[model samples]
Target: MADPLPGDVIDRVEYDVERGKVREFTRATFTTDPVHTDLPAAREAGFDDVPATLTHTVVAGHQRDQRGFVDALGLALERVVVGSVTWTYLRPLIAGDHVIGTRRVVGDERREGKRGGTMRVVTLETEYVAADGEPVVRLEEVLIERGEQR
Candidate 1:
């Protein structure tokens, strides 16, 4: 089977309202849009609350899954290559919301490179909502960490 990188990992993160970290991410990442910073701007955008910058992902144990992908192939992390990074948000992420822990695979063909080179790409999807879980926001994050070819 595709047991190249055969380990399991879980990442846990929490987000809330009235924090400067969001604003800091916006500024550091060069996301100058007011919606990402100014609550007033977000309101104009039809958002009931401030929006989360695209980069503000809950990437905690992300690397752990990548490590598993490699182990399943019987190859080490030094054998692959990072290809791309992507994330999609189903709804606007506002403050004072918490997202639960979710699991995702390396996508189709996580370990397809064994000869020329490999792109160890993994896309993670997440959702943030009120305590009731109405699906307020959905996000898909892509992480690529290359490995070595033997």
Candidate 2:
């Protein structure tokens, strides 16, 4: 498969921040920060409402796109590994907020590994924006696909 251009959009997803789900995420992540689970505490912390964890955007963006993007590159799940992840938070995500996340290909590189395998490094950037068009958070992920020529 030909490589996607730098500005190519891979996929877009929309999600609603449910309070219950946010609270559940907080618990599962073992976050004791009340700003993520309690509305009152969040307000006291200067947030308008209960704020979801920063990683939630990654979770929402990656849920259904894992195979789609990998397969598009003729790679499978077993050969793909997360190389890195970075988040730039512009604004907090609150419960009841409607968000649209877009995944775009920012860069790509091919290299020959010492083991005689071809590896593709894909750099993708996902931006989560609120319904009002305010940027909530941005996630930059680097994924390494191995055995592309095996």
Candidate 3:
């Protein structure tokens, strides 16, 4: 497969921060934090509504979709693994806030694996902004795609 060039803008997506989705995410992640599920509690915490969890951007950013970059690169989902991820939150993403996120290919590298195969590391950096145009979160995710031994 050809390498995806660095600084490639992979996707631009806009999504809403629905309260119901926040509740579901919090419950599914076992994140018993009321701020993430209860509106009143969120208001008490100085938010207008429930706030999304840290990892919510993964879903909100449409990173799980198996199209676009992943498909273009011909990467096998079964051979891909998350190498690392970092999140920097500038502001809480509250329910009802529409978010616009842009994902870019920041880094790409090929390395020899310990098992004598080839490993490709792809790093994607995404910045999400709220409806007000304020930056909400910046996420960097590294994915490793392993190739069979030559």
| Model 2 per-residue lDDT at 74 | 57
Q: Is candidate 1 or candidate 3 better by lDDT?
A: 3
What is the lDDT for 97 in model 1? 56
Candidate RMSDs in order: 4.9, 2.0, 2.0
lDDT of each: 0.56, 0.84, 0.83
Model 2 error, position 96 (Å): 1.5
Q: Across residues 1-150, which tens digit of lDDT does each residue of candidate 2 receive?
A: 777888888888898988898888898889989899788899999988899887777558445666787766555678889999999989878898999988899988988988897888889998889999999889999988887553
lDDT of 3 by residue, 1-150 (tens): 566688878777788888888887888889988899877888899998888987887775353465666786567877899999999999888889898988888988889988787898999898999887889899999999999635
Q: lDDT by residue for model 1 over 1-150, one digit each (tens)? A: 543222233343444544476787787789878887787888898877777777666433442465654455444455434454455566666755565544444353445556656555655455445566766555555555555434
Instruction: Return whichever of 1 and 3 wins on TM-score.
Output: 3
Candidate 3 lDDT at 114 equals: 87
For the record, the alpha-carbon RMSD of candidate 2 to the native fold, in angstroms, is 2.0
lDDT of 3: 0.83
lDDT of 1 at 31: 87
Clashing pairs in 3: none
Give the TM-score of each candidate. 0.60, 0.89, 0.88
lDDT of 1: 0.56
Superposed Cα deviation of residue 138, candidate 3 (Å): 1.1
lDDT of 2 at 56: 77
